[model samples]
Every structure is written in structure tokens, then in C-alpha cells.
Target: MHTLPGARDTRRAARRVQVRIGGVVQGVGFRPFIYGLARQHGLSGYVLNDGDGVLAEIEGASLDGFLAALRAAPPPLARIERVDVRDIPPDGGKGFEIRETIHRPGHTRMATDAPPCPSCLQELFDPAGRFYLYPFISCTQCGPRLTITRALPFDRANTTMSAFSLCPDCRRDYQAPGNRRFHAETIACASCGPRLSASTDQIASALCDGAIVALKGVGGFHLYCDAGNEAAVRRLRVRKNRPAKPFATLVADLAAAGLVAIVDPLSRRMLERPERPIVLLARRTIVAPSVAPGLRQIGVMLPSAPIHHLLFHALAQEARRRGTSAPACLVATSANRAGMPLITDNGAAHAQLAGLADLIVTHDRDIENGLDDSVMTVIDRAPACLRRARGIVPAPIDLAEDGPPVLAVGAYLKATICIIRGREAFLSQHIGDLDSPQAIRRHADAIRRMTAFLGVVPLVVACDLHPDYPSSRYAQESGMPVLPVQHHLAHLAAVAAERIVRGPYLGLALDGHGHGHDGGNWGGELLHVDGSTWHRLGHLAPVPLPGGDRAAREPWRMGVAVLATLGRGDEAGRRFHTVPQAARLAGLVAGGAFPGTSSMGRLFDAAAALLGICVRQSHEAEAAMALEALATAPRGLVNGYRLNGGTLDFLPLLAALSQPGMDARTGADLFHGTVIAGLSALTASHAARLGVRTVLLAGGCLANRLLADGLAGALRNAGLNPIMPRSVPANDGGLSLGQAAWARLCLKDGTRAGIPGYERT
Candidate 1:
């Protein structure tokens, strides 16, 4: 090794060293930042991008200071997961330079897509700028990342941008060290990059004329129509095979969004954030009723791309000429058939959306991966991510400790996968329900893609305990160490993973369905968890599920089951006389040929049916949502309930619902009030016995705003801390996170520790 001349004898000799940094360092201007930092310190070295991460060799008097600064302040978009430093011999290099990218077999972190920066937005509107009115304008701080990247090292050649060469001015900016566009892989100008075509103008005009337009976006294709045009919105909904589900709307800005929805401080901030997720907010009367039928809250979002900005600008100009306000809002729903993967390729979109859309507006840039826009809402005055995708995905979550790599296959609905390497857990984007062949194939593809990108070979495979789940079957078929985790326990663990809560706390797992430890269908469970161990403290009274899965789709059947459970079987047929299966379901309930469940979702279904709100559901959680919407006033005259040894029975509430002359709205309010009062009392009793003060609310049923808000308020008023998920989802979407967390704990505690469901393959 060559040291500084005459400095070898000094206590601190100037020697050369190599450093490798990993985690989310590519496509985020890391090399340019390194160049500026090196020059600032007067170092002689070179930095290059590689499959693993950024590698640099530096020879300087202040090498230690340089390393400290690199860690202390990184780029705004860069996330440093790990740094490895080693000594190296000096090569007597004179100046610092950025070297060519090196491709290898190792793994590296990928950055999520970013929104357009302020500088790019300003330049887009400048008439003299070269990129004025360009839809593909972007810089290092903004534009597509995961959607365009095809391989590691994150260079232009490895991305879809290879088709568009930079113009002379753009090339100069890219090569200049002082410019922000320096080393920006996606940088392009209209002269040499992808150009806007006349078809886009036609599509924009059609949108203004109240016609549905399908436009290709960063992640996938989106169906767009004027939000104020009820006819257009309804037509699009009918064509897409969606009737009651609310469609998310995209507006030009915060002011435009406020005209249709009640935007508070939190909602406005979430809407304006770079991620640009759909934020659920209270709706105003100005919006078309067809946008969100029978719902009080509407999903709202702001434009995140330059193309969206151009469309809004064109609409504004046309509206000004017509002497009216601009068409500031558009229904931006994903362009896909019912229960299928999102359309990514231009040809596929044209083939699938030809009949549904009046015009198609698309581009030539390829989308390497397709993702949906994320969904967010405020729970307990904090932002809760309901669907994690697009601008927020491919980002790793930190764990408490490092362990062996594990792959967790999540639940059947809201499917996702989790890959744990070292102390970072990488989660896949939302994969739809695994009921159809297409959805199942997409789920498998997601696993393969995520594992390949992260370069992880899991030492253990984890999944839910339910044997019928496709995820469980997939894990069983794999020739690896398998671990099955209980469903409710996993839900509690997901919340604990996000909150970093050390257990011994009460957890309420309320959802649609999950296999129970007792071989029964379980939900609405009260559990106490600590580390890898959990104990069921109590649960709601079990009721027969007549006709099995059919009872879940028909709320009237559940109402009849409730009547039978209350020892009023003779009235079941008479109570639901309108339902065709009412008499048969009563006979089935009497014959005892079906399994019983303790599901909170079934309770909501019964209430909705008894009040004549929703007797049959065309989608998941339809009855529950309808019941929540019917509760328009404060809780009125809560009915009585029975708290037995460990089971909370609602027979009294059911009997009250069977009585005549009760208004449907008032009955809905009463049902919600009874549940809140009963559950709160049950929790207070158990918490006092266990001497615990923290309570976690989890599971899919918690998605209802009325229940979550009411339960949180009651828990706080009782002088206890109520914890809800903030980073991960509260639904089955977060199952894999919990499964991975529990698997790590089980591995740490040893295989024969006597945990209930810990079995190694």
C-alpha cells in the first residue's frame, strides 16, 4: 500500500480505502451527490454503480470525515441501508470521476416512482423552454423508476429510456457537474426524446366533451371522464362492470379538490404529497351522485405526472373560451376488466379498452412492472395506508433484529409476499384475490419478480394456518422449511411489527373469516400476545353459517341464522319471507349441518339485512359499508348484551332488531351502539384482569370508519392507549408482514419451545 509521502510515520497516515453502500441508491442521483461531496473534500477517487450498490475508492487526508458526512446527510430520495468499508492500496489517482456502471449477480434496492418536482413544473409552463408542453418531461428528482427499470445498476440502457436519446442541450446538462440533470438517467428533451402526438389532443378534447378516455400512465392505463358529468361517469361504470363501488377522482390541485370534497389539514397534506395516493375525504353536494353512490366519503387525489398537468391546462383553456369554469376533475379508475390484472402494454390496453373507452391516449415507453395507485385514510388522527403501491412500494421496512432469510406467502385476499433479508423486509405490491386463474398467476409472478430483484433465497417458508388457502398450498408444495401461523395471531403481529410494541397487550381481531385454533371459523377474537406466543382470552358468541359460503353472500341468510341462534327458529322463515332461501336456510339451521363462526362481519351483515338496507351483496363488504352509511346520527338507545365467562352474546340486540315498527336508520344506529358498548365493556373487564393498558385494533372489519372511530374514542375515554396500524394495512394485505415477524421470533426462541403452531418441515 502506498501512503502519503513523509506521512507514514504519522499517527494517522493518509491511506486509501474502498466503501460499498447499499439500499435504494440507484436512480436517485447518488453518483452526482458523491461527485459533489468528493470535490468538496478535495479527494482523489472514483465512484461507480454496481449490482450490489455504489462502490467508491478514496484517498484523502480527511477520509474519516468524508465517511461521516456521507452517512449523516444523503440525498433526499436516497435511503442508505448498509455501508461496508475496507482498506485498499493507494493507486496515486489525481482526480475524482464517475465511472461506468458494473453489472453483476448481486442485489440492490429499487426506488419507487416520484412526482414531478417544482423546477420541472415551472419549466413545463415556460413558453421559451425547450420542453414546454412536453408530456414526458422529467429530471432526477421526479419521474418513473420501478415501472421502467428492467435490470440492476439502473442505467439508461437497462431502462425503457434507451429508446429516446438526449438532445444537445439535454446532453450538456447531463454531462455538466453543476446541473441538476447531471447523471439523470431519464432526462430527455422534446427535440430528441419521446414526443407528444395529435391523438393526445383529441383525447383531451373528448374528456372535455364528457366522453370516457383511456390514457396510459406511469404504472398502468387509467380510464378518465369528467367528474361533473353524471352521464359519462355512469356509462363508464356500467361498461367497467362496477355498479356500487366508489371510483377515485383526480383533480388539478388542492383548491379544485376542495370544491367537491371536505379537505382538512391532514387530507390536504396527503393529497399534495409526492406519493399522490387516493385520500378518503367527506364529500360535498356539488359532486355528481353517480361518483360515489350511497357513500358519505369520496376518494380524492391530485395529478402526479406532467401529462396530467397538460390535460388539465388544455381543459382550462377550452373552458375559458366557453365562458365557464375549467373541467378540474376526472374519474381516474384503473383500466382493467373485473377481477383481473391491470393493463400495461399499449396493444393489450387497445384490445381490452376499445369498447369501453371513446378514445385511447397512449405512449411508446414500456412499463416493466404494473402497479395500482395507493389508497390512504386518516385513522385516530393519523395517516393509515390501506393499499401500498405505486410511489410507496419496493421500499423496505426495518425489523428489530437480523435473522435468516424467510419468504412469507400472505392470505388469499389482498395477496402480497414478504422477503426478509438481514434487518430489512421487502414487501410486494397489492396482488388481487387469488380466486381466478389470472389472479393466481399474477400472485406467483409477484413472488418470483420480488425474490429475483432482491436476490434472496429464503431459508424458511411461512404461511397462514388455513389449509384451503392457495398461499398455504403454495408454501406446502415448496421443498423448504415450512411454518404455519394462526390467522388472528398474524393480524396482531402485523400491528405489533409496525408499532414496535412488545406484547402482553390486548388485541381485537375483527374481520370476515379466518381458520381458528379450535377448527372453527374465527373472527371478532380477543387475544393476548407476547413475543411468539398468544392466548385467546375471549370471543363473540358463535352462530351457525347456513349454506356455508352462500350465507356470506346473502345477508338475509345470516339474519335468519341469528334468529335461530336466539331460540326463535320458528320465526326465521316468517322473518325473512321475502328471501327465496329463507325456509331452506331455517331447515338447514335446524338440521345443524353447517359450521358456526364468530365473525364480526356476519354480525354487520345480519344487522344490514334485518333493517332492510342490503339483503344481498354483489361485492365484498357491501353490507357492512351500507350499514355504516345508514348510521347518520349519534348512537341512539343501545340495546343490552350478555357478557358470559368469555363469550360476548348479542342475543338481546338480535331480539330487539326482530321487533316491529323500528326505523331502519335508527336500527342501524342502535346495532352499532350495542356493539361498541358490548366490546368496550368486554375489553375493560379483561384488561383489568390482565392489568394491561394497551389495546390493538386489527383485521379487515376495522376498515369501517364508524366502528374504528367509535372504538378508538371509547378506548381513549377509558384511559387506555389504543393502537392502530399506520404504516402497514390493517386488512389481510399486511398478513405477510406479521407472518415474517412471527417466523423470526419462532426461529429465535428455538424450534421445540412449545409454541402452539410452530412446526418445522
Candidate 2:
């Protein structure tokens, strides 16, 4: 190599280049960040938004520094999916500028709303700041995006904020390229932006008096009450018709969060994420017995909106003046009627929540798209999503390969929709169980809204194989080409798609129930999945399921069924002597045939019932959750299970629990351990037989932290790769994504052999 003596280094020479960026770059401070970086590098160019994403052209001697900063440090919320750079002739342009958005046909991503940034928060509490005490404080760095958006090309004209004109000071900030609020669509001051119906002090006073307040939040309305007030929590529960379900509590900051929950490093990082999700953690103290009755963990979140911060600030101030301790936290939950969607309109919040809340604190700003708080918990020593909403909706999962556009209306419970375009799969916010007309309507609405957001019309629709289910019915009526997929297979495909693996792997799905391809109720299954095709390799041992779906509600029925299978049918009546149905169950014809299942979820119910844990589930998966809660130091028994060919049975473990004087906690540990051991052994056998080293664990049963983490650890020790659900939930909430991906794969193959995906081996 030779050094240039009398010549300038061309590498550092001034040059012009055009850069096209994509991904979650729109409405996430990308333009403002570009403006700052260009100015810092003394470049002359203009950056603007377009249907595709952000585009820029810069020319300066420091082009290298500008390009490095652009790719390395974008806005925190901006997820750069692609970057295309090309040399352009320099035109000797003026100073850099943030240009207007170009409206056209293309694709760009929108991120869900986030909490206020550090700079905005500092100004919010500063007396000298113009936005001090403002509940709608925001900047280019953070604020609502997806929830307030109505159409593409995210801008003030395309948002709900268009209803509120910015004040002079705020307008100036928005127009200034160097200002923090520059191009912040939701930016406004107290004088111009929306206002709370009640003052923060009034809300605080009402809370101190043990009153439930329905407060309009970032995405929708939330029912709020003092978490420390036992009477208030119980009253709210009774009024909301949520008898036993736990309520999430919101705090001011990490210090406040630590007061109520055991905040470990991993948990703290989840809490501090800008998306501001509710994290389930072990309770440090019982704030209120009724808040989460019969539960060892509590769901907690930090302030995601300015109003939430204002209320806590006012409460602390009032407590100081009164010489008393302030309420540590507030019980906050979606302000929707049971089994329905969140309330977005003020009139609806008042009309529907009149009886449940004492005060209705609503605003004039409209909520274009409503979402509830995201929920998470630790699994496999990492955070896993329980419910993806609020700050996490509209996050696309990059697909394995490009395919035709497809829409998938999720399962019957925990309904969510997915719209796939090109290579990205856009999953919608949670719409809840489609058991009511209102819920089904909202589910339909979410589908329409998501398609509009993505600007893509699906060419095909996908649904579960169960014809009678609401989602399946909707797909049949959707008028698009329809592809039906099995429930458990969809679960396995979801994890596969998320991991971006097009492979042959072992899939173990342990769910509550799924409509089998052979027209039977299936749950626990072991299969071999190869791309768009799969084969049923094995499953858990089948047991008689009496009363069909009723067995899922009453764990005692499963207990009776298991006893009958173990040649102990005579014990059902004497064991459950208090129940009148017990005698009838014991007297059923010995040779009577009923629908059978290999469901691990039903097995959990059986264990819970025999251990005298939960007789009738007040909530879905209540018995299983209770058993998991009580489990400690699970230890597998030497002869707990038997594996014969493709069928694995746990009759010996059930028999051990049937013995008199077995403690509930001890039985729980035994059940989890035995199940883990049996599954590990069975999976190893199949993996060895099929020569597959990678394993995918799917289904709702994997949501149990004790079982998922333990089983994953055991599988790793067995020298096999085990993957869990990460981008989406392991429950029915994630089913739509799987359905969408499976449909994409089928469309790619386009063969009669791909139909049904499998033929019984």
C-alpha cells in the first residue's frame, strides 16, 4: 500500500448519496433524528417520509460519520428493517431540512405508542417548563402512534390529534427542526390538547375515599382504584363481575414497583421497556387480599401516559399535605364489560361504566384504535408475552419467505387477527374471547382496521378446522379463498415461523383442546413438521372425556374419569360423597364409550381435583394455574409414567395422587415433574427415530413457567434444540399468526399433497 502525498483522500471527500430506509421508521422520530445527524455532520440535504419509509439525501465532507450514526443510532422506537444507499451527484444544496411526507403507494411500518421519554418527563415536572403539569406532554422521541392513527403516512393530518390544533408555542416547537417536539404528531400543550374531565386533585381525592374511577388512558379507558384499599378492590371486582381474576396495579417508577413485587434484573428490564407492559412477578407484600386472591404473583406496570403520572403526583402531594402515607399503587384494568372490548368513546365509557365506577374521567380526543395493557412474565429466565397489546401491537414478525397475502382470524378464545403482506406478518391487538355478539363484532372490526393499516387486501383467508367456531365461520363468510388448518398444528407453525426456520423438527403441542383432523378432540400431541407438511408421530395416552366440554370446567369430572381408567371407578362416589353428581358418575355403565383425548391440560385438571385443589374452575385454566402456583422443587418419581410405542401414559402417577393423605402442594410437584420426565423421554425417542435435533414446544400448557422452563432445560440437557413462543403468546392468542403462516406455506407449495398437511401415518 502507498500513501497519497499531494492528493486529498477520496474516502473522506465530500459526496452526495441517497438513502432509503424502511421498517418501523415512520412516526418514530426518524426524521428529527436524521435532521440532527445531518446538521451535526454539516451536510446539506432534506429528509422526508413516504409510503415506503424515510428517504434522505446528504452531501458533506463528514458523510462517513453521518451514515454511521444513521445506521447505528436511530430513534429508540424506530426499527430499521432495510437500508438502501446509492451515490448521487452533489448539487451543492443548502442546510439540511426535515421535508414534507410524500404520499404514494408503498409499505412502511408503524410502532405502537410508547411512554414519555426522559426529556419530556423532566419538562413535565419542571415548574419553568411550558408543558409543566400537562397531561398530554410528548415529543419526537415518544407518544401515541398506532392507537391514534387512522390511515397510512403517519402525520398530524392522519391522526386523532387533528381534532386539536396546537397552541402557538407548541406549533413553533413542532415546526422547528432542532426542537424535540418537531414533527411529533401528538404534540400539544394544556391549552390546546385534550383535557381531563376531572382535575388530577379531584381524581386523587376520589381515590383516597375508596372510589373507583374510570379514567381515559393512552389507548382506552381504565377502571382505577386504590390497590391498598381492600374494600375498594372487592367492590370493583363485584361491580365488574370479575370475581376472582386478578387486577393489574400501576406504579410511578421502578422504586414504586419494587415496593410491591420482587424486582429482579430480568423483570426490571421488562418493566423499563418503552412499551410499558404489565409484568407478573412474585408479590413482596399483600397490598390487598382481594386484588389477586389465591395467587402468589401480581401483575404490575409503570405509567405509560401523562395522566397516569399526574394522578400519582397529585396523590403524593395530597398525602404530604395531610401528613399521611400515600397509596403505593392503583388497581388498573381495562374498562370493558366482561367478555367485551375496551371502551374508547367517552359516551360509551359513561353509559356502560356508570355503575362500576363512581367518577368517569374522560377526554375529547378520540381513540382511533383501542388496545389494553400488554402482559408479560418470566419464562426460561427470559420475559415472555402473556398478552400482546398496548405498546406491542402492530409489531410485525418477519416471515421465512415471501408469499401471497393471507388473513387469519384467530381462535375462539383470546382472539387476535393477522394480516400478512409480502414477507411481514402484522398481528393485531387482543380482541378477547368471541363469546358475545359485541366481541365478534370487534373481532371483525380489528380485521378491517389491520388490513387498512397494512394497506394490503388479503387474497386468502385461514381459520381453524373446527367449522362451528366463530373464527372459522367468519373465515367461511369472508368471501376470500379459505384454507382450514388444525389447531395444534397452527400452534407449532407459529413458533416455527417466529424462529424463521423452514425445517423438519419435532413439535410437542400440549394444549387444552383442539379439533383433530380425524374429527376427534386432541390436545397433547407429538409430531414431525417439515416445512408445509407434517405427520402425527405420537401422543399422550387417551382417556375417556365425559360430558365433552363440561369436563374442562369441572376438574372433579376429570378426576372421576381418571379413577375409572385406573380400575378405581368404585372410589368416585365415596371420594366425592358431598357432591350429588358423584353417585351418578360412579354408576355410569362400565363399558360406556365416550370421546377420548390425550390432553395434558386435562391431566393437570385431574391432578388438581384429586389433590383437592380446585373442584370447579371460575376462570379458564384455573386448576392448572393453581397447581403450578403451589408446585415447588418438582421431583420425578422412578415409575411415574409408561411409554409403549407412540402412546405415553401417566396412570401410575394418577394412582399415587389417589392415595389417602397426599398433600396438594406435594402432589403438584409430583405431577409437574412426572409430566416433564415423560414428555422429555417421549420427545427424545421421537427425535432419535426421525433424526431431528430441533424441537418446537407449543400450546397453552407451555405458558406455565415452572413446566416450560423446566422442560426446556431438560430438553437442552438431552442434546436437542427446544424453542418456545417469543414473538407471540403460547396460547390461543397466538393461533392466528400460526394460521396465517401455515396458509402462506401452503400457498407456496400449491399442491393437492399439501392439503390437510398430513395423512395419518
> Pick by TM-score: which candidate is best?
2
- Please give the lDDT score at residue 231 for candidate 2: 95
lDDT of 1 by residue, 1-761 (tens): 22232333324556788999998899999999889887776678999999898999988776766777788889878999889999999887788999999988677889889888898899999999887888888887789998898877789999999988888898999999899899999998878876544444676678878899888898999999998889998999899988888889988899989998999898988998778999999988676798888988889988888888888988887777667776768889999888777888889988999999998777888888888898999887889989888888888787767887888999888988888888878878888788877778878888888887888898777899898888998888887678888888888888887788885899999998888878889988999887677899999998888766787788998888877766677776777777766877777787786788889989888888877788888788889988888887536345468899679988788778777777888888888887887887788888988899899999998888878888888888887788998878899999999898888777877763333444654
Q: In every candidate, how many clashes are there?
A: 0, 0
Candidate 2 contains a number of clashing pairs equal to 0
What's every prediction's RMSD, in angstroms?
Answer: 3.6, 3.5
Error of 2 at 16 (Å): 5.0
At residue 149, candidate 1 shows an lDDT of: 82
TM-score of 2: 0.94
Alpha-carbon deviation at 539 in model 1, angstroms: 1.2
Q: Quick one: how many clashes does candidate 1 have?
A: 0
Q: Estimate each model's TM-score.
A: 0.93, 0.94
* lDDT scores of the candidates, listed in order: 0.84, 0.87
